[model samples]
Target chain A: MLKGHQTWVFASKPVIRSASAIGGPFEAKGPIAEDFDTLHSDLMIGQDSWEKAERTLLEEACDKAIEKAGLTKETINFFLSGDLMNQIVSSSFGARTLTIPFLGLFGACSTSMEGLALAALMVDSQSAEYVLAATCSHNASAEKQYRYPTEYGSQKPPTAQWTATASGAAVVSANGEGLRVTSATIGRVVDMGLKDPFNMGGAMAPAALNTIEAHFRDRQLPYDYYDLVVTGDLGRVGHSILSELLPKHQIEIPLDRYQDCGIILYGDNPDVWSGASGCGCSAAVTYGHLLRKMKEGTWKKILVVATGALLSPLSYQQGESIPCIAHAVSIETE
Target chain B: MLKGHQTWVFASKPVIRSASAIGGPFEAKGPIAEDFDTLHSDLMIGQDSWEKAERTLLEEACDKAIEKAGLTKETINFFLSGDLMNQIVSSSFGARTLTIPFLGLFGACSTSMEGLALAALMVDSQSAEYVLAATCSHNASAEKQYRYPTEYGSQKPPTAQWTATASGAAVVSANGEGLRVTSATIGRVVDMGLKDPFNMGGAMAPAALNTIEAHFRDRQLPYDYYDLVVTGDLGRVGHSILSELLPKHQIEIPLDRYQDCGIILYGDNPDVWSGASGCGCSAAVTYGHLLRKMKEGTWKKILVVATGALLSPLSYQQGESIPCIAHAVSIETE
Candidate 1:
């Protein structure tokens, strides 16, 4: 049901029956490498192209999640997916492989939470018995499309965040025992006229703050209502900016409970200038690391705000400012 | 609420309170030009670039629809949109301008009905009071990204379809007196391993057929239940293919009621090789021409099956086949 302005309060609390994360070689060296259900030593995962490798990651995540849920591809009612690919071909091809009724989405990196929110809504409304929500991104694939080809050995600026090659998928069931999706806050597009694609973290920070503030206001929850509040791939720059902006807006949360997927993905890695990013960063960390912690009773309730810098290479080339958005979904265990 | 596999029957029937379509100069010369709410004499619509022009078309259509519904942008609860552009910049930028809470979808050309179906579901479930569903495409922009640049004047095959420069928007509300959305059948990704991007209609025909058959089967409705069964943009080639394939599956929709938006857009224009296409083709025809006729009581019920070819230039260049999808929504008037 509609709660306030942009939030949906799911009365039935659609349960996250199972989740799986798949990663590439780069992610296997990261701090939370063990959290992923499967990690490929080869970035290609035996695929010919980087794009195909990205699609393979999504397929593996989805298949693993479905298997973990004790369900087959035929049992799922719908598959909601998207990726940081032109025309979202990875998701479309993955959908073809899965053969589930599919809904393709495009929210850049925020696609992870966007799919989850809509999937939870479908289950809560009795529209489906089971729905699969998934998203992915690949470093080489994204680099080739948005910047330069991986073979170029391009030197990125300090503000540039490394795109993580990863994919995550979750199965939401109408009847299950697991972490439940309690509510969701859809985001409004926010642009501060920032045009730096390399500094996506800075460009997206405002949108992240906007949705987080809206989520609290609409849900009418206290600042400490969530045991943990994590953002999707905001990197170090955006994370610091949000931490600073929150207090200015009179919003207060303990620093210990405030974390970011981008910052956590590759802790202190020198190669990643700012931090890690991409649709897969938040997805892999959340579904893999965070969800595992929640299942182990490390936290009972948490909020995952997936942020996206909605800019194509062409948009920035055309001298347009970066438009950003964030979608927040609250997950809790009884 | 769940009718059968892949179908949802809305019990509270969400109403299409208002709809508006905008078009470029080429579309202004079409047979149904007068049906459009606004037709720009210049393809640019005074914008400097084709992408911005596409965004402008979406903005105009949304504004017109909201005005027709006597509602302000602030009154609308959410905006669901998508486009054919890379990263769907048109919808993202349009959402930025509107400042509405947004959900960005990527269904290639099927975005129109995909947005409509999601919007109707939100309204029918009381998750939103008023939701705006919109999509757009610019011919030049799509040509530049997907094929050759428009300025290249490259010789295209006779099988190629013209990408339309158009946009369409509709307002779906929880309570209204207008055409009601009764049911929706979400489509699965259907790839027949068709590799010719030039002949998209041929590649997408199977998807359109699959969804149409699923719609009839899941809704437990006869093929002739609808006064009209209009397809998105199968064009001349795919239209004939579908016509021949239908009877083989024991599905018999009346010939008079079966139509394609691609075939109707240009009438007998030789310049349009096969017919019109893009995310905007079906959108403009259905929201402008079809809805107008229904309002005038010329038809009581219709099915709009928006089809899409989910392939990118990279995918085709990598020798991957085109994956296709179609989403169908049932609109009726009492």
Candidate 2:
């Protein structure tokens, strides 16, 4: 079913049967560390390169997701996934090993929820019996590709956020006794002419606001409808910006209930500059912490707005401004 | 809508109301030049950078698609697009300008039919009344990112194919009188342990064979069920490989009716090495040339299997074997 505009109301309300989150040493030290299913002591994970290590993380998370659901890889109809890798090699290489029908996506950091939203749509529409949605990000791999390698020890700006080394996977099915996806609002690219690459929170905040605003308006609901409204990997800066922008848009939800995955993941770690930011930041938090809270009867309904900064290294070098987007998914206890 | 193991049997059978193809200088001199809606005389397309030129091509093709359908851009519910660039900036930047709900995809060269297949599914399921499917590739931009800049004038290998400078867009609608999309088979990654990046045709042929075989098996269709079974951007070598591999799989079809977008695009141009190969290669040829032939009653009931070699420059440098996939969509006139 279509909402007013920009949103899809999943009539069947697909259920998330099982999920898994794998975190590295850094993520394991974060605030919601206990929520993660597994934590690695090292980033390499016995792989030759950081890229292969990232692939290993995705593979393990996916394997765990199916096993937790009491299912095998053959039972999953499709693997809808993406990553921050240049051509999304981690997910693609993982798919090669998983041997499932694959749809490779790239939404930068927002890819986790983006994959989940699309997987839910596929399952709800009866296009598949079970679909796997997953995403991963490695701090070292991302730094090497998008910025200077960590080995350089380069001076960074205060606005720079730490990338989490983590992977998250979820299994969406038509019939299940678990968290249900009710609606989704797909986002549009919102470019505010902000060119600084380090200030990704500033670049992404506007997109988050745009999609969040659209979701509320199209659903004919107040800002307080969701028990929690969370933004993906938008650190303290972006979170503060959103607090200011929402009131201006006539949305007046309590700031206490409006949290950001980026800020909440580490819980005021001084080393994490702004906050934890990556595809894995939201993925690990949502599939781990939020779902655990919902299962514990701590929250009834929640909305996740996964935001992405859509800019390439070449685009930035060519003086092109960043294009940002945010996709919102609503989940609730069934 | 789930037909068998992997295929989606669209109940409503969404129609392709209108499509537009824009070709660059190299494509302007190719075999299907006259079939394109617009052709630029220069590779740059009057833009300062090749990336922007590619984005402009996509924008033009999308605008032409909606306009030719006698509809405004606002009526198109979503835009599904992707390209060969890192982070898929061309498509994302294009989406920023297009201002439609965007679902950015990345399937390397197979993005054309992949976009078309997803758009058709959305429309068939009534998720949207109209959706835009498009992909583009700029030769210079691709060469700069994947290999060397064009100005280097480096010696080439006979196995290396030229990337097409072109863009193609199609408007898929729920209620329309046009070519209808019947079924789609989402592909699984198939790796043959071949590592050469120059020979993408060889790398992707096995995946193409995989999906094509699955489509036939799942749909319970015979080998000659369609007038044509065209593989996307396989050039000559992969085309011959498929010819051999299909019979080995015990699926025998008349070889005369078989075609490849890469081999057919340039029509025996020696400068193109084996043949044209890019995201634009299949897109430009299919939406412009083949659809025109279908409208002219040249043939009916065709299966388009778009293939992609999902290897990045980083992955190639990492010494990983190429991973490949091919998505097949059935189109026919009613």
Candidate 3:
């Protein structure tokens, strides 16, 4: 977001909103009459491999965000970004572009929330006046590196999410005239030892539920305090499980007001089984949908929770199951 | 630099005075330690693949350095680290473990100096009092992902430096009694357009030479002003070229003082021709040799310039020569 093509496309809108929830009907950024339908970064120069492509996306995102925020790169205190790559390449690439000091973060599909949580802490601690928290996912890179390539024609399970071929970034400023990260609860990385990566939604529900449960308990806030509670990349299966498990755990939130990135991607299409979970799913959805809602002011408080699966090929080969972790952040309009 | 088995048979101590030069006649950190050295990380749970093993090494190195610097996971301002992996996984993993918001950096082999430059800028800006600038490299991971794996038995040229099978890390803190990043000049990536991964030393030498020349000219510092100017993993062939090139550029540094990671690997052994220039080459040499000299007080006012060969298999496939970059940092005793 520093000073990149994507941010220019999004921030060109004459009207910007201030809100907490993407509760109002969704609206994309920029003028509808604009001729440009895409915001792309040229990857021809230094990017050749899939890894390089990932780095390009991250660096471009950070550059655009920093530019959009109108702050010197050195003044930005911390970098908080995540991706689906084995070691979070996207964030690392973003960190390299600017001379600003930074940190890399990981939360699997729930990275945006994790980033937001860390950003909120840095702001609250007065450690940094501004922090950049971004997340990205690439379909081509993810396919070749994580799942099967398009040529493999491997069947995806209902719970699996198609990683986005995009990147989203945000600049979290403590005193900015926009929604602020109010509070966050760092979720425990709980491992139920679930073996199926395809059904990660089912495996990650427990961790999300635990964090949400703790968030409300710690703040003594009621479930109704939040207008929407979003879980990242949890397709239909995990959503169903979370809906049932939350109630079983004596915690309840309205199902209609709950959403997942997996559901959003299909748009009522039957092909997507559950949802999508990649580094980009939460990032694009949050920036596009949630930020748009905050502009319309339909709701006051919204919660975004991102989940990640910690598994390496070697671990899977050794018969190890996936261990899931989730991090939650509350965004509200002041 | 961390807890690892099969490493650190010998390690050079970080003496206060003589460790300023990055590639001078300094002792290595763990390569000289006693036999049966062990490296481990507290946060990461698994390490079966070469990638995971490298991740473990980097994570532990940063964790130990940060802990020694008396900063908490949240207190440390930011995490800066990089490597030469396909997607630069080592730095990403380190960020996840430290959980101190971080940025992933990539100056390729120049990552350490680049990281320190950014950390110094952050400190100067008063954005954060403490910034942990660290870099790591691993032989197995870099080879398999960046070049042909050792198992491939690919013939390496005389110009190539053997990738060091190690990871090295350090903490840059404003309040700590360690070497401070006194001055830094970001190197302009110079592409000599040399097309050979095996002979990366040759490709990177021009960039290293460029940065060295630029730094002295920019700071108005003359040759022989300091004890030494150490260039990162320029291997035997690249080091020789650098020694030859500097004189042509009207900047003369002693050839006896000129060294490369590969030259130090076997230490005058003809068998390990050239030297080591993988990501770990610069890292091990810097943390080992430079830090040792600083501790011993044998030298002062050393210029540590780390160089990187920016090449990927995809680029090679495109018939593109590897373009290289270097970053020069001046580290002096507190």
Q: Candidate 3, residues A1-334: lDDT per residue as tens digits? A: 1110000011111111111111100112212111111344443224666656666666666666666677666666556666666545455435545534444445566677766665655455444566677777666777777667779799876567666555667777656667666666655546676888678888888877877886677666778788999888777888888989887888778777888766664455555556566766666667666766665897677888777765655446557566666667777766
- Candidate 2, residue B292: Cα displacement in angstroms equals 0.3
Model 3 chain B lowest lDDT segment of ten? B1-10
Question: DockQ: which candidate is best?
Answer: 1
lDDT-better candidate, 2 vs 3: 2
TM-score of each: 0.99, 0.99, 0.66
lDDT, residue B247, candidate 3: 91
Candidate 1 lDDT for residue B64: 98
lDDT of 1 by residue, B1-334 (tens): 3423998889999999999999999999999999999999998899998888999999999999999999999999999999999999999999999999999999989999999999999998889999999999999888888888777789988889999999999999988789999999999999999999999999999999999999998888988899999999999988988898888889899878889999988877989998999999999999999999999998899999999999999899999999999999999996
* Residue ranges of candidate 2 with Cα displaced over 4 Å: A1-4, B1-4
Off by over 4 Å in 3: A1-136, A169-192, A202-231, A238-258, A299-307, A310-315, A318-334, B1-136, B149-152, B171-176, B181-194, B205-229, B240-266, B300-303, B309-311, B318-330
Q: What tens digits encode model 2's per-residue C-alpha lDDT throughout A48-90?
A: 9999989999999999999999888888999988899988899
Candidate 3 per-residue lDDT, tens place, B1-334, comes to: 1111100110111211111111112123334422112333221225556766666666655666555566555665556667766445456545556655444555667777766665665555344456666666566666676667677788765666666655556665445466656676555546676888778778888988877776777566668776767878887788888888989988887666666655654466544457766555666567666666666896766777788765556556657566676777776665
